[model samples]
Target: MADEVVSRSYCCFVCRNYVAEHDDIVSKSFQAHTGRAYLFSHAVNIVTGPKEDRHLLTGLHTVADVSCSDCGETLGWKYLKAYEPSQKYKEGKVVLEKYKIVKDFC
Candidate 1:
């Protein structure tokens, strides 16, 4: 089987603003608190909220809570630091997924 191409767009459910295209969605995954979500390769016009330290076990690193830039609804997060020299590429990636946004119907 092949991966189906999603030909439509998705938006924040609260704001209905264009955030990501189907091709931008990198993959789908699950979490204990939020269940299923889609990780986008790129996110547009979003406001990343205040940065904070996370991952107590691995030592604290920076992250920001993400939100729709227009309506201020909580979306997901942006990883701000890998906390190490080699893994810095993890920063600036977004986690706005199916649970946080909806398919743009219009």
Candidate 2:
């Protein structure tokens, strides 16, 4: 089971406490509608922000507006989109993957 985990979740480039395990990631290293890279997480520690139609692929998705649960630093965003029969898997998912995150330590 340990080999299946490709990464570990942490605070936004500050705190080292574990937030979410990589095992729950729906999509890893995936490209977003903004032409940027992101990881679709099943779990995260973030507060909801204003919903907007920023990206075309995600529709009018709300931002998670997440900061570090331990420290106040911009962590990531959870895309809250309207549920669809074909896209039900991405309804309550998060996007927080940049150099600022902890991917692997060993």
Candidate 3:
């Protein structure tokens, strides 16, 4: 018999739609309008809203709201563009509020 590995991921709190993989998390120290959030390198099953410039804690960034494709719940936002040179790494990344998702194992 061989040992099987379990994969961990995050799902939408409202509908349990798989949103992000555990391995894709880039930072856990992020803050959102509600509270703590996480930065992810990749996200799935989400719909991105319009892009608008917002002054974040780091700097001004062009961001779009991300919602669950299944339930249309506002999950978080996607970084479309970061104005600060040092914040450029965040562009194309996604931030999901800690309270908006639940841990899922498969």
Candidate 4:
């Protein structure tokens, strides 16, 4: 029999709603307001709040709070605009706190 490849993903810790695929992870060394976070190229099953400019560890960035659509739990933020040129790559990406999500296999 051909072996099947199991896909790994990250789910909302509060409701187990799949938010991001493991393959979409950009960085696992990001820092959030609470603790460590992961930068993802894309996120699903989430809703973005109002955009605001916040001075983060990196610099000033326009971000929007991201929450799980299922349970309305604040998961993290999505980078809308990065003021610093070096951080521009983060624009349009989502960062989900490590503690706010759980891993799942399928």
Residue 94 of model 3: what lDDT? Answer: 98
Error of 1 at 8 (Å): 1.9
Lowest summed lDDT across 10 adjacent residues in model 1 is found at: 26-35
TM-score of each: 0.73, 0.61, 0.97, 0.97
User: lDDT tens digits, residues 35-99, model 1?
Assistant: 66665667887888889988733345587878888898887777688787664655676777467
Pitting candidate 1 against candidate 2, the one with the higher TM-score is 1
Which of the two, 1 or 4, has more TM-score? 4
> How well does model 3 score by local distance difference test?
0.97
Ranking by TM-score: 4, 3, 1, 2
- Model 3, position 56, has a per-residue lDDT of 93
Q: In candidate 4, what are the lDDT values of residues 3-82, reduced to their tens digit?
A: 99999999999999999999999999999989899999989999999999999999999999999999999999999999
2 or 4, which is superior by TM-score?
4
Query: How does candidate 4 fare on TM-score?
Result: 0.97
lDDT of each: 0.72, 0.57, 0.97, 0.97
Report the Cα lDDT for candidate 1.
Answer: 0.72
Note the residue pairs that clash in candidate 4.
none
TM-score for model 3?
0.97
Q: Residue 14 of model 2: what lDDT?
A: 77
